[model samples]
Target: MATRSAPPSDNLLARIALRFTAFTERWLPDAFGFVLVGTVIVLLLGLATGQSPTALIDGWGKGVWSLVTFTLQMAMIIIGGYALATARPVARVIAWLATIPRTPRAAITFTAAASMITSYLNWAFSLIFAAILAKEIARLVRGVDYRALGAMAFLGLGTVWAQGLSGSAALQVASAESSPKAVQEVIKAGRGTGLIPLTETIFLWQGIVATLIVFVVAVVTAALIAPSGERAKTAADLGIELKPLISPLEAEPKGRPGDWLERSPVFSVLIFAIGAWYLVRHFVNATGSPLNALDLNTINLILLLLALILHWRPHRLVTAVREGAPAAAGVLLQFPLYGGIFGMIAFTGLSATIAGWLVDISNPVLYPALIAIYSCVLGVFVPSGGSKWVIEAPYVLDAANQLQVHQGWMVVVYDLGEASANLLQPFWMLPTLAVLGLKARDIMGYTFAMFLVCFPTVLIVVTLFARTLSFP
Candidate 1:
């Protein structure tokens, strides 16, 4: 890793953060273990809610397969994104970006901002994109703490991601077909429409403002507490080596016809040409902003096509993808466990019961705050913004109608809380952890700091600015 010397000192806050890191390093289990325990917790919660053991078991079994498609999509982003980044041209761009930040604090600020801005486009893509950026920044910037960089790479998911274009609730309610029937009814009653448009949800000026405030708060906090000097644990200090990606698909001067094909660009160009046409069509027929047109498959298609063009050979891209597969293993194993947890909460009526109690105590003034907290808390268990939002929209939007609050604002509120919990959840941290070759404990301290700064920033932004996106 290149260094301009060492990162400057901020031992005061660094010392405090180190204490938390130490505790987590000592006690926090592997993320897979965390999910297993969460499964147990959800099981217990279901049983305590008077659900039959048979019912809970059935839900658990059934729920395990519910997120299978989503799991594959997440896995693709990791593998495909890594392949794209390791391409020579993309690596060069990243290398140039790394040189831009001369100091550790500036590096962290840039990373956090990059993560948030890209996440605003698409959270899944942002995870792998920012993770790659953070690693490159850590490589070029001396004295930058790897843990802080890793956390900043992940800050996108927990901070402003759910408030952006790909946010599940916003997009779900933006279309009547995608919206749950209950939520559709709520929207009709509240807005005199069958769906809540993104114009009224994520695209609302207040949501945009709140997203910006969160971006600043998180970036500032990350820079302020970024470790330096003796407190810094750069990637080298942690014994992690940065290795350049190499392709095994190089041309063979004396080999068979298959070797020639492996090294040729014909297949890749053919595929890329097809994908490019589809991308143009996708955006041209897009419903909202072009940014909103970025769903998971669309993003993966773009990444795949870019990687194909960059590698310029079908087999070379295959090698890059194979190298990236291990990073997605965590998602493969843990998501099903979370799927079961989602099933337990949804089928056993645990979520509705908990939401019911919250509804009883909430009036309009406290409603947004309550929903934010509720979404954050629920997010830890479910960990899926899209599917979980489907489960939440009915009761959550229903309560908004009852309280006479702007129903669309509640989506923003729910998103705020949903994202806040990700800092502590460790679920979405898998991609960053894998890319950086670190454990969840290694980065949780910085993410915890992010939560402290971003969560309250979100709550206040929503409660005070409710009128800006006022309901009917």
Candidate 2:
């Protein structure tokens, strides 16, 4: 155990967090392990509640593939966001940013701020960019702790991404076609189109305030608890081979007819034009605020078109997306398993039983906080935000409806909890870990420290902000 690893930091939080890091380094299982284990636990729980094994098996089999369409949307969240972030211009901007932070503290704070900001735009983009930016910052800034940098780089996903534009739950609920079973119930309950627009979710004034508050808290917390002096571990001290973030397209040979077509701007421009026209027409046709037309499909299409134009060539964009495609591999693999879990709960009486447990414990005033805490705990073990929401939403939102809670607030609440747990769950840390050549244990200490701060901060914000939103 690294509890006695003679770490360099004297900061009380840093010391405390490393104890958790030491523990997790020894015992933490792979994210897939969590899913497999979760499947069993849920099955057992169902059986204990009087659900037959045959029925549970039937539900699992039927539900395993039920979310195929929704799965694709979630996959695109990573691919589209990756392509957009790695575009030459964006990459250039990130490189320029690295040149600005000279001191260790500034470097840490800047990385956190950048990660949170870009994550709020698209989490996949933020993850990649933060990794690249941290690498550059570490090269330039002396005495900066690499682990702290990695943790700061990861703050965006754990803090405010879910409250931002590419947030899965918010986007899912915003589209009637994409809204899951629970949201469909909401729709049936007379939410008009049964769609909660972005305007009422992430873009709401209350949500915006919550996001800003959380962002400031996270950045500040990162700066305060970051290790320094003899306690810090630099990339060099850790013996990591730092590599520059290069465009994946830089390696391809030129000259073949196919290669020429790939490199040519014509196809990219044509596709982008077609996509842009549709987006414009979509807003033009909107019956209410044009922004309400922004949904899961709209966001994905916009990301696709933006990436195409920014890359300026089919080959470059395709290569960029392909490089980032592996990042989505986890989602493709785990989502079906989650769908099965959802099936067991949603298709069975397990949902009401679960809802009853939640309702039994929380009144409307405390319900949001309870849901946020529960979501955070579940997120540590099952980090599939979109699919996890699908599994829990049927019961969670059902509980909210029972208490006459604002359905949209439930989405916001779920998002807050889900993001907070990302602080502890390293599932989404694959890209950052790869980019930094670091293991989950190295940076987890800092993230764990951040979680200690953020988890409570989120609960308070969710509870206090509950009044600012209500069911329409």
Candidate 3:
């Protein structure tokens, strides 16, 4: 007969991570204030690095508006994704999945698995779907822990999104149309480096393996730290009650011809038909080709078209937008402030200085790890992957060229690092926490558990796999 060993403790690393999470909760302000702090930090760095006050201030002013087009794209992605999640069919699916768990351990584990898979489809959908699903499961399964389940939902974004179809940095670098002008220009400057195809990044074996590892680790961690019995909080205990945000039934307007048009499915179906045609033609044209057109634009267009088709009625789409708009408010409010920080970093040459320091320390073998670590730190201050890539891609790509590193692996490393930092950074949690009616502190503990469990996995996988791809 064998005796089972004692269950593992949270470990020193996990304890430290939890302590850091607690410290930040007490001291760190909301996402808006976080960006404001970032702006100040960037400004001070600019001044300290010998930039004139006039130039620094002017850079911030111009930078704040530099991302107008990109901002619109991001906004559409969020709202469109939310609209897709709000569809009755999607809600029904989530509700069905919520009933599949029989125990608290099974509930948390299943939530983590489902959330990670959904995140790999689209981060926005993952956020809304997982939050609602967790709540639904908690309501259905007595003694389920809302805090653990909520953290699992949020953990998906921090874990698998970097390897996902809608991942911001990966999609941006994979196609010219999806990349910002700044990123494209930098790619142009890099020697023999042009658009990186997703086949080499997201579709690669390394990416697939790393993502699988992350999902497994996340689920296991959720199960390991989950509370039991009286410690568990049910849906009611957590005060999470979700109502239908978008109603399928539209109220008809009296005596107005346009009202009929607005409420009819015919026009919306026609519009979605056009979008469907574009998507089909896009893939058809690239059949059997190495070059493809799947990017952020494609992802957003598909999301929008799907939402329109699902909603059927034009007025329902409007209602869905109204429902989803609040979740995206934080993105709109904080993105421009980050745009300014981007300006300060890019225009003031701070990014170059940082990049140069890394290049000086990096050999071929060390480059991937160094890039990953650097991107993790950068992700904390600028959580927008597209925005962060716009600033970092130029120097990062240039260094990769010099070191003979594969651009695909370089992009992958950067993406993994950014996603890793999401464990510590709570910017993306604003919408998620709002929907779940939980505080950041409630979820951060489990998120940090995942971070401790998965960060080294990312570091090791990317570092080793990048070498193989680059050398081979």
Candidate 4:
């Protein structure tokens, strides 16, 4: 060129900055903004409400401790499960699962059943397992779109719906915070000393019926809304010619039967033992001292240490840890920011204010439905089930007390809200997106429609069920 390009003018630079800011607002961690803004309001409230600075500091301290414990537990579940899933251990489990049946219909049914079963073990684990299994099934089916398969896998896993009904971490925490005595009575009634109500015959039956409705609704909606035309045609076009069977490379790794025990039997035993211990400990505590102290956190820490020791050196544990760390890094980084956001909310009394408003709006007859809506909204800010429980549980309990709402029903509402919102929030969908190599915008287009359809159905059914049972 004859002349060099002129430097950008100030107005042009300002315009560029404005556009960049707008772009960030659209794509960046908008979820984080919810928490941040809430925190600021909390701090201002604390200051305006004439609360002592010391009290604010103390509350912040408590919040930090809670965050640390919750994050650690979550990290263990995510990292341990991820490592196991990607390694030889989970391959064996899937191999056994595959042997049961590999048909498209069977894959759907088995995935749905296994999801419910494993969700109690760990929600994160269940989700990861289901995602991996779905991918495998899609590969086997050849012409099937992986995205469609992913959606099916998500629905079948039932992580969101089941978490609301019973035996979910969020529900358990809500139960404890709301009415320790009622939770105890539930345990005594043989509800198994978890978040789920003790009236298994009644509560579980209702839950099962409600779960079925959700299942059918989800499947139908997924089928109808699944992309059509070129995308759908491509998958359909390949359907007939595409092999119904998977190649050895695509299937779970299988080895000599005896050798299978050598590579991962220890981890298998550890997982089983830990689960057994958790259940046994819960049962013992229910019968004996309520102060039962079997620290699952400590157990998880010990298991991780053992994984490092046993799988170190010859097993290349370092590489596994390295690879695994990246997967968890996003969670680890975002969690602290989330904690700060929670801190600000607590400081400003925003959570209490919001919860109070929700309680005020709720009527005895329509309380469950209202609670569900509130939970869904709060879920946008606090996506982690455990963390959401910790921050919102106190306020929810207060609201329940004030509203004379049944704690179990309230827990149900909280579960539905938290779980349903997961499909929309970028944070929860990241893992699914990562697995599929899809963008957030693309994934949201599908999940958003799913959310709109499922959210109302869940609200209506859970509310009606709660009323019929005379749930408090």
Candidate 5:
């Protein structure tokens, strides 16, 4: 692997951050190992909650495979996204962005903005897009801090994804059919509010405003603390070499008909034609709304189609996908472990126990804030936004009704907290790190810095906006 340059002596904050980054690099385990440790911690928590070891083991066994579909979806997202990023047009765009950031300061800020905006469109897209963009920036910018730029790009997701179109919690609450069990229970209890429209949640003026604020603060934060001089990483520090996707071998003659087929665009174009039809059909079938059609599977299919169209040849797309697969292997290996942990939490009633305590201590005025805090804590363990909401929503909804707080406000609060807590969670960073050929340690310190800056910002934003919604 590549080595970073020495930390700068002049900037105290930069020096401290570099030291911290080095410390984490030296001490932190690989992403798979880190999640394995997290699984063990969750197992202990299950046992502490009076679950029998035998039952907990069984729950883990069952839970480990529960996310099979989701795992495939996530893996497709990474692999497909990476392939899409390698497309000629996409590479040109990245090259253009890379040239724009003439300095280290501009590099990180541009990365932050690009990541935030793209991630708002689709979280999966954000992962590979930002990493690829950062890689190009590192290649182009002379003094760019590679590690910092990588971390900042990754940080952009947690900073704004919860308020975006693909946000699991917001979308979940917006759809009655897919709403969490707790939300359903609230309806049965006569205390639950009806389905919240996306307009009232993710598309609300406050949420939009808050997301813009986060984007601005994140850019400013990047500007303030970006390492300079010796502290920054050159492209050489990456240790990995960058290559254009267009191979010279592709221009050489193919040996057989199958080889010719693979090199031809006909197959890919045909596939895209079918996929495009399906997508159009899907959206048309939706009752005059497309937001309901947005989800992991849909996004994955669309991305696959885009990649095929952009790459223009079956063989090239296949090669690009193969190259990208390893980056997603961490997710494949660890999500089952996470699934096991989820099983223990869900089966053993630990989620309810924790939520119950929060309800017990919460009052009307403090309910939203407390729930937001609770969501943040829970988010660390169950970083899957939709799943976390499933566990927290029932009790939180019941409690909110009793406290006379608006249920929509509760969803907003949970969304903010969940996204904020992901700042500290490394699970979501695996693909980006893998793509960048870096470890968690390289990015942890910077991401932690982002957390310090964003967590409070999110809390304050949620509180203020929630108050407005509740009062109105």
Candidate 6:
């Protein structure tokens, strides 16, 4: 029988379909797939290792529930805060930031410094604020490359050091070494407590000094490596300044007479509420049940509700929530997969196997050096310091116990691993890429160079500091 060939239109349609699928695959975050795959791997591992399927399923169910709830809470905060901040006229924010004096260099420096410091606030907040500030600084400079500056700002603000110093995951690990209820104890100890080995611990001064020295080196290196002349043109070309902030009044200047609450009302009431919640939760430890739930999620929910009340627009609130959903979808989806991978590690004894190997090689004297290197390597896969710490902290604590390593030394190693790989992670490049409207490939070209130079410098400093301070 003579074969009937496919129609030209059908072939064209098939090609177009293929092209569309490829495009979606290229850009859209594949976190969902990653999670699903990880879950399967975990399941397979459970079966292979003769672990009870029922237990695995139960554990996974709880982990997934926690992951989803945590992801949603984090997403809401990021989206809500971003929407509120962007709702205001960008020109006003720029004008405000400009009045800070030496608007160009100072803004860049402050933004960089603030990014580093406020990372303790929350990574999402730091990223958003730094991005906004970098955009404003770019506008003031007229011809400076804001995208590059944005990358630098992110590096300084959101880097591993900030993550390490922040009393979050790393602190929990360090405290766990001495106390089982480490997180609560560390919280009780307050920010003034010696959580970071660099800032605390008697023998680990070298590691701390090394971290500082390396940070300085990284900063100087970034400054030296920034593009010069025309190569350093404004981020305007990259579409950063395209979305000019329009005032709500300007959008409807001749509308019905503005209400009393609309005219000179405090828009920052939400910010204040969030602050009050933090203070009550962290310091006062208020007895009220409501105050207890005022974690990252509750705080964000409070802000969103406040924004809605102040704006008095149900439609706008819905729209903001819809818009914000995508902002956190990647994390929401991808973290679960990581959780699944973690499940496999736990079920299959892979993590324990790795830990045993590490313990065997880990000498108390060399633990700091080994930890610094191990952390840097791990940085490739688990880019987020907070997230990485969650997975690795337990192992580190276990290793510390096995080798009789000090909690302070362990903390130093965790920080070293994290900091050395900050410039190298592809995920950390997102804000810069977003600001620049560039692909990862383009930015990686520059960032990889920075990473190559910075990593070795940091490693050496960490090693020297560990040796000098006698951390172990």
Residue pairs with backbone overlap in model 6: 35-337, 115-157, 116-157, 206-465, 376-417
lDDT string, candidate 3, 294-335, tens digits: 555777798888989898887888988997777667767777
Task: For candidate 2, write residues 1-472 as lDDT tens digits.
Answer: 1233445445677667556666665676665666687789889989999998898899899888987886787678667867876788877787788889988888999999999998887776677678878988898788898988988898899899899877888877776656766567764474555677777778878788888888888887777776667667789989976655544445557687757888789988898889888889998986545544666577778878888999897878888788878777766887788778767765777756755676798988999998998888667645667777876776677667677777778888899999998887666786676666677777777788888888888889888888766654
lDDT of 1 at 193: 83
Residues 1-472, model 1: lDDT tens digits = 2333333456455666666676777888889888988899888887887888988898888899899989999899999888988898887777777778899989988998899998988888788878888988888888898988898899989988889878888888886556778778877887788687788788888888888898888877877878777668899989999764333444447668768878789888888999999899989887655654777888788888999999887777898899899999899998898899888887777888889889999888888988898889899999998888988888888788888889878888988899999998789999879988999989887787678778888889889988555566
lDDT of 2: 0.78
Model 4, position 321, has a per-residue lDDT of: 56
lDDT accuracy of residue 356 in candidate 4: 73
Clashing pairs in 2: 8-230, 8-231, 9-231
* Cα lDDT, model 3, residue 39: 83
How does model 5 fare in lDDT?
A: 0.79
Expressed as tens digits, the lDDT of each residue in 1-472 for candidate 4 is 1322323432332233223333433564444454455555555666675656666665655554446766666566556654555554555566556556354445544554555455544455565566666555555543344444554455532334434233344334434543356444543343234344334321455656765666667655554544322233222333323232222333325667764544554654565567667666664765222322223353355445444444423234444556555555545655665665455455546566677776777776687787777777766655665556655655565555555656655665666667777665566544544443333443344455567777888888877877665434
Best by lDDT: 1
Q: What is the lDDT of residue 179 in candidate 5?
A: 81
Q: Model 6: per-residue lDDT, tens digit, 173-226?
A: 334242245433432343333334323431245554654565566555554444
Compared with the true structure, all predictions reach lDDT values of 0.84, 0.78, 0.75, 0.53, 0.79, 0.51
The lowest-lDDT stretch of 10 consecutive residues in candidate 2 is 1-10
List TM-scores for all candidates, in order.
Answer: 0.94, 0.82, 0.83, 0.65, 0.92, 0.66
Better of 3 and 5 by TM-score: 5
How close to the true structure is residue 176 of candidate 2, measured as C-alpha lDDT? 60
For each predicted model, how many residue pairs clash, with residues at least 3 apart or on different chains?
Answer: 1, 3, 0, 7, 0, 5
True-vs-predicted CA distance for residue 268, candidate 3, Å: 3.4
Better of 5 and 6 by lDDT: 5
Clashing pairs in 3: none
* Pairwise lDDT winner, candidates 2 and 6: 2
- Candidate 2 residue spans exceeding 4 A from truth: 1-9, 70-80, 168-205, 236-239, 246-259, 286-301, 318-322, 378-408, 431-442, 467-472
